[model samples]
Target: MPQPTGPATAPRAPATASSPPSAPPPFPPQSGPPPQEALAPRAPVPPAVSEATRLLCVGVHHDRAFREAVLDELYVHEERFPAPSVGIDAGRVLSHAVRARNHEVGWAGGIVGLWLLGLIVSGGLLALALLGSVGLVVARWIRGSGSADTGVGLVRRAVAFYVRWLSRLYLVYLFFAVVLAALFLGGGTFSGGSGFGPGLSDPLGFARLAAFLTLLVLAGIVACVALRRGQFARVVSEELSPSRFPHAQSDPAETTAGPRLSHLRTRLRAEQHQPLVMYEEDWPFRGFGTPFHTWSLAIELRPRGEAAPVPLDNGEILRRIVPLVEALRVPSPRKDPAAAAAVIDRLRELRLDECVFLPADGLEWRNGAPYAPDAFAAHRAAALEEGGEARRHFLRIRVGGWDEELVVTVFVRVHTQGGMLMAEFAPHVLTPVRRGYRLAEREARRHRALSWPGHIAWALVHTPSSFGDSVRTLGGWLWGELRRAFAGYAGAPAEGPSAAVRELGTDEDLSLFQEMDLDRYLKTIQDRVAGGVRTALREAGWATDEFDQKIIHVANGGVYIDSAKDSAIGIGNDNKISHTPGGKGGGKK
Candidate 1:
């Protein structure tokens, strides 16, 4: 036999290429974490040694390309196959290549020429008539006097106009053909009388006309379909217009060299004597309107048996799935804390471990705390509400392994307008197929429920009093007490807004946590301040003799000042302090 191809060497030994330096031989797996060496990061391979991995490391982490790639793969895979299977490596390779080359499928004038020629050859005079009609429509509908045949911009606009006109023309032709055929056939009969009626002449002409009409209608339909396909091509072209069209396919045989899945599969295959399948699926976290940005996959680890297939139940399989989940999660500018936590819960329910894939940013916060995407979509608002404005996005993932197979799903949601994308994987380890789907229902639902009111409240309450935005700032002691009461969670406080109930204007003391202004902002500063001062005096700390409390209102700000010894005490002169700015109690105003 011809000598083996020298391990298909590419700088490093095949075993070392994929496996960690300290890990056991990936071919024959080790029990129990493969030692600490297996967990250790692999030495950096030179860019020339393996460009794919190098590019993947940089590309996926930097931009949304890898994230979108996974989503696109999952959606396509789900569409093509039912109950997803990643049985063939060729399928995954082909799908990946298709997505990779999606942007490059351009009309190089040759394709356009072919299409035009096809139109002429196929439609002949009818096609010419349609083109003439298109020209007329373009002239009538479009604004510019200049010919649209010159610049790319003009050409595009002209093409759009032409296509739209062609579509309408096709519809009209189809309608006339149908109506005419009905009138002739129904109103006349077999070349007698009125053809369709009893007094008509020959109907053969009508028949031929109908046939030609049918043919024309079909041609228009075909052209419209082709045009839509081109539009899809254009969308892909727009998405992948970046300068770098780098391929991110990781080699399976290389341990730490390429994508983690590739190496893990190689090692698992070496250890087991059975066939395997692996794939992924995505789950959305944000409300319906946002995109499904996070994903999880389930991998099947089945082994061959005489009676039925058996799956491996190794703990290491569980261990490896965690990293795979982590790898699927791509960083986006928009992120929501509660939604993210919900994603974690969903992943755990799916049995994919969450500890391995936790975001570097800590997830803990008070009830109404906002996070990342909130930071990115930042806005300035003038509303006198306690809560500041916030924007949210979501990402979720799910992964699992079953009987010689692996699966994963990633969902990505960005912004309030909500662009959602999902990635799913089928369960075949050898060549796990990836696909993607857009989350439409999820996208719509989020927009409806997102709380613009609550965001304004949070902003108003969170902003400093010096900003002259706090509604209760002038309410003095009463406002202070109320504000303090509201500061705690809605449930614990003795007096404050109640929780968010669906009904309008009823209960006042349930809990106001996430709900916007359940207890309402102070209605009038005069009444609130008078009430607050009385409450504060009842609570003591202020003596009329030693100090004086006076309310001062200027164009710059309103202040509660204790004017004693010619100095302001209770509230700050600069308007920053809420109460007792000079650290002394005040006399009543």
Candidate 2:
């Protein structure tokens, strides 16, 4: 089995109010929380583990679809890239989810107890629903609503949950009705006997008393969930820390071991551990996630002053801009020379990788694929030296700021073929996770006594679907495990970004500050990349005026990329390079 892939740094407990010791980060988190998460009123957020737990808690506590997606990928297939953080892992999140589902499914089983209570009180048509629901639920669990797809199957399963919950609720009402009918009986509670001296002698009186008792129990639970705050989402996030759940330092399958789920750790790691930023086919770039902005400039390299033109290759151009882009990661020394913090003040998340992206079929899938650094380095060098449409080269600059809630990525590709120095500048942004996810943090800080009723009402509203959600969760899990054990799920159809938890709650558009930050990151990196192209031109005795003009045009937003389809823009000759998809690049100068 393949090992888990991600940051090698082991996870630690979050620094809470009780034990507030903090280790200095490689750089500061940011100036403040992201816009959506800004009003949460949380303490200074802990580093990787805290944010990671919150992410996990979202899947564990709130979203059932996310759980299915994560588990399906973990049990069935391999990952495309290494995890970005040590704490936010597929296996760890899946274990937390499994623990949560076990508890929910356990509670969902109480419907059977409700049915038995109804059977004892009254065995009418209602009692049959309570009894027959067990068989229906079991059948549905086995059949699994075609659990493989996310479309109609998900709706069908959710409907099943509501149906089961409703049947139990009906039985509760029947039990209440049967208990209230005991006013005319003589003694026995079931036989209408006067077993109790004071109670069940009048139907109205019994109804009032039963209503009061039920409300009391319901109110107490909802009040505790709302006021005490421990039952909220953020608490789950904190509880998932390595101190509470030791999976951070070990295999997660051990925490919630089961034969139902196979290859928990291997599939989570996905074989490659070097933190290669994985993307999706949302836009022009297949695996580069959504495209925020893209601009390319192709300028002919001419000898300056009739001098012989020196050779300039794509590797040289890419190599030149890489360190220039990486230099941004360094923090400037404060004015006070004596102040040596060894940490950044703001904008901490920075990473740069020079690598090749192979097509999905081109990935190495052998068991325990050895990490040969020298061999990988040579492969990257070859990609830079000889670029292809399928085997592409890139200098990826990723700025994961705002607790990794907002990420800005810049993919720089340079090509110096046929005397044309072509460069593509693409910038993409991952917006803050869904606003609903940040609710846990806010809920943790709340202590509203009056809001308990609202909380109760909210719980009541979602109660009907409890059966379907919980049962489907387990049903899907068991089915997946069986598939992994027998049919082998390694070759299941690929689900690109949907399985990615970080990308799950992200919005299409960036927030105000997030937009500004992304713009700054893209511009700074683009400047460095463009400068490298110019530097190579100067060294090769080539005229850089045409390239400089196009750079200005791109910076000023004077170029319209969307207007052209399957085309490359060129200057100097004032011609166009037509690129046909799955065909060759053809044009005349």
Please give each candidate's TM-score: 0.19, 0.66
TM-score of 2: 0.66
What are the lDDT scores of the predictions, listed in order? 0.27, 0.51
- What candidate 2 gets wrong by more than 4 Å, as runs, is 1-53, 78-88, 110-121, 125-179, 182-263, 270-288, 331-348, 362-371, 444-471, 485-487, 491-498, 558-589
Candidate 1's residue-wise lDDT over 1-589, tens digit each?
1111111112333455667777543342211111222222222211112222222222222223342343233222221111121111222222333333332123212233333444454334234334433444444345344456679658667666676566556545644654565445423454455443332244444444444454554344344433433443333333222222222233221212334334323332231111110111121110011111112212222222334432222222223234444432322223653333222111122222111111112223212212233322332111111111222122223332111112222222211111111112111111011111122222223333447564334322221111111111122323333644554422331111111000110111212221111111111212222333323323332222211223222211332322222232222244321122111111111
On the 0 to 100 scale, the lDDT of residue 275 in model 1 is 13
- State how far residue 583 of model 1 sits from its true place (Å): 60
Worst 10 residues of 2 by lDDT: 580-589
